[model samples]
Target: MVLIFLFSGIQAYAVDPEVPDSEEAISAGQSIFNANCKTCHRLDQKLIGPALRGVTDRRELAWIKQFITNSQVLVQGGDADAVALFKEFNNTVMPAHDFLSDGDLTNLLSYIEFGDKVDPAAAAAAAGAEGGEAASSGGGIPNEYLTIILVVLVIVLVLVLVVLGLIVSVLTKYMNKNDDLDEDDKAFINQKTDYKGIFKSDGMIIIVTAIVLAFVVKTAINGLYTVGVQQGYAPSQPIAYSHELHAGQYEIPCQYCHTGVEIGKSANIPSANICMNCHMHIQNVEGKDGISPEIAKIYDAVDNNKPIEWVRVHNLPDLAYFNHSQHVVVGGVECQTCHGPVEEMEVVSQYSALTMGWCIDCHRNTEIDTQGNEYYDKLVQLHSESSNDALKVKDIGGLECAKCHY
Candidate 1:
């Protein structure tokens, strides 16, 4: 019966694309999860947080939103469910999520509801519904809007310029005609012809002002856009490595490849010795006998009988600094969080935008892991004073420039 209702709900939403239960809410909820919840919570399994499966059945939407928006508060308020869950999890408060708006919270609730009652046919139909729309579009500023705006702006600018030029020409001719007058008269005429003064008084003044304003805005936007992009950076390697296979299918733990992340300053590229540990035994792969061609690259660098060439990914610029220890060890950020799902990738790619905006967004929204990290003991103390017990990432200073830049 529950499954039947779920299927009916999906079909009902589908027949009415403008309806609330349609994919928009589901996709928005998915985005919210990807951005905020996936790190600690899984839908079906016990991770850092309780499995979210069947959450809708167990909790009301209002309670779920409040819990997600501020779990610590519910725990402190002695809400039996929140308090019991908190204690069950060792009194570790789930991080507060004050950033999600009411609409976003609703979307998440809808998704949770859908997940609980999902039917396979409905799921398939939902997936197939948007295929045509996605494939036909390119990802960038939409050309249609860009073209329309640019054309309108150009036309307005040209009209303004033409009017200004006409006025200037008239003034210039009048001034020249008065050239034969007395010197004082000529000086008066020249003053009347002053193009700069005319520009200040005419409609041209507004046009020039608008142009300057537009230029300033464009420059400021571009400056902000480049703040955290590392387009072509390549760094020296501890060992030569090939991403082709490891990422391709051997599907080694990203933590395995970048092991140092669990304990040190970087998701440090594995040292040559680490490579030897694996290469020494599983020297061959993909049915190619002997040290696979890629593994041989590692052996070459180690100066062992065989060698390997490892290239660095996620290289921070010289001006910027990164600490794997701080993020991985202290913040409890997963290695794959910033580096991306490297195990499933063919070649490593810079997955996170690593932009200041991107970093700050995560920092602002992510709940800090406060339970065991002594660094957050003081913050946890203050939060306890409030009836609400949520601990925000900001409360722990995740957005401080020194946290990343220094």
Candidate 2:
């Protein structure tokens, strides 16, 4: 019955010519949009780039495809519309998505044109539902609003201080006019605080000295703890290879390049031959004539039989042992779970802290996938008997020192 409904729905679906109307295509396009375009462009709203909802009406389908694939190509070739857009956006280089195929682009356009559509009434309802939280969370208050709020707060605080001063002055005058007051009462009321002298006293000096010393100690300890943690480390490679184009925009399977990830302890660096498999043919891009400088480096390395001296980014300590196969294959963890979005990064950086605490936290939280594993059958049964909760990695020997240690 479900299959019949799905088939009927698909059959009933119809979109514009060349653009897909199917649920699958639209869903795929949404994923693609999230991965690449969401950073700069929005479908219905203007972001860093223009709103892209009605781009089809503005430009031909072929022109849209060309511009998306490589906008600079069109701009340099004196395409009037492309040049205007480039100038309008202050010549912000929209990263080349030549990695995207024809089908991918068509699906993307389909989503831009047809997906996430809501009528005026529905939009109003959604706006009402979102009210306060949306207003607060939309990148905090605007800078101008924040500045105004701060100024108002300062003014109010100053006004309060002034009123307090006036009240104190009036009370002091009233107290002085009282002839019934004793000598001790008048002396107490007239007493002046020596703030400067108090600060210069031994106790105040000791407190300030201790606070400064404590702060220095804390900063030193923090620096020591961060010695091995290279969280955002990004080193330049010998050859400027872009993971954004390959891993992200192109949707290349990570396992295709990093072959040993599922099979071995180390996800070994891909050889030049693996690069040449594609680059041997794809020497130029963006309708260019000569070989690209970056691609030339690859060709040179291949011809000379010398390995490219790629700089290592994520380096685990010698004491710590990490196995890619254990986490990726056995545990079914996504690469993005640890490595972050390598597809979006032009130069890949170390996304995770890769610290002991981080690993332990992940193990404690991540559920163990025991399905189809004969070894886990007894363990799962035992775990089920002990606790109603799903079996986690830490519940097994995941937290055990020997599990990760040599």
Candidate 3:
């Protein structure tokens, strides 16, 4: 009885006050935090402020809520913890989150405490997904397979030449040994091939002309296919922006910068004010003495009321119409599916060919994700009845000429 009581006391002392652990509460909290707190705070990492995992345990719930509503008020009121926290962070003032309700705070705390608790199964699944993504990023034959094919072709060609040479040597020997053959016939067969005459022969000329014409026609066809395809077309922008650092290292969401990607026809280029939202506080990369030169351009543009002229890397011809929202929001296509591994790119480039043929190929191959979509329910039912294959994008008008063309 004594041991059980002691253990119970220890467990109670170790655990923080329970926050709501329901999925609904945590999900609601996630929305509020991503919109407001995500820029400055993290649950486990010290970003612009302290890690927030143990806030409910360390401070009174009311005090935490009041400080979140307005930290400056608490600091000015000489609340010891708030003043100390502000001083600890070099007097950085946390913005007032007066808009969040009491329920919102509870939900937010629930997410901070119990959400994303690192399930081993989920981690394994995530690793598998990353491997799949890497494998799918490459198209067509792998490099090693292509190398092996070239090697086999060269070997076959060499064998054919060796066999032909052996046949010629045997024929020459037979002609030299024969007693019945005339001297003139033997001389014609045994003599060195007339290299000069062969070059000038009508047969040689015809073969040469045929090869040249074939090459020229093939070149013309390939050139026509690639007329406006600008794959790997990375252009210099006005500001030296590093997508690798921002998107890859910092892990900022794509929609955060390309704001309209999910909502509209265009993935809108973020304005200078959006840059200021972070740069106003960040100023420079960690360990730098002053503002970064590239970031300075953003400040200059915002201050001068002039727009930064960013170079467009991807261009679609006027004949084609692409709706970003249709693919991104409705179809649930990943940005990387078309843009390649943009998070790894230091400078943005046209990764995909973005040609009509490329689009058609994608439509032919990509299966329509019809789960939970009422619009696709009837179409999927009909498709299943007719065909055993999963419904592809092409089945529902993805390849219709008018889909892209007027």
lDDT of each: 0.66, 0.82, 0.82
Comparing 1 with 3 on lDDT, the higher-scoring candidate is 3
Candidate 2 residues 313-355, lDDT tens each? 8888888899999989899999899999888999989999888
235-306 per-residue lDDT for model 1 (tens digits): 333333446566555666667657777677766655667777876577666575433445545544454333
Identify the superior model by TM-score, candidate 1 or candidate 2: 2
Q: Where in model 2 is the C-alpha error above 4 Å?
A: 1-229
Name the lDDT value of residue 287 in candidate 3: 94
Report how far residue 350 has shifted in candidate 1, in Å. 0.1
Candidate achieving higher lDDT, 1 or 2: 2
Extract clashing residue pairs from model 3.
none
TM-score of 2: 0.46
Q: Give each model a TM-score.
A: 0.38, 0.46, 0.46
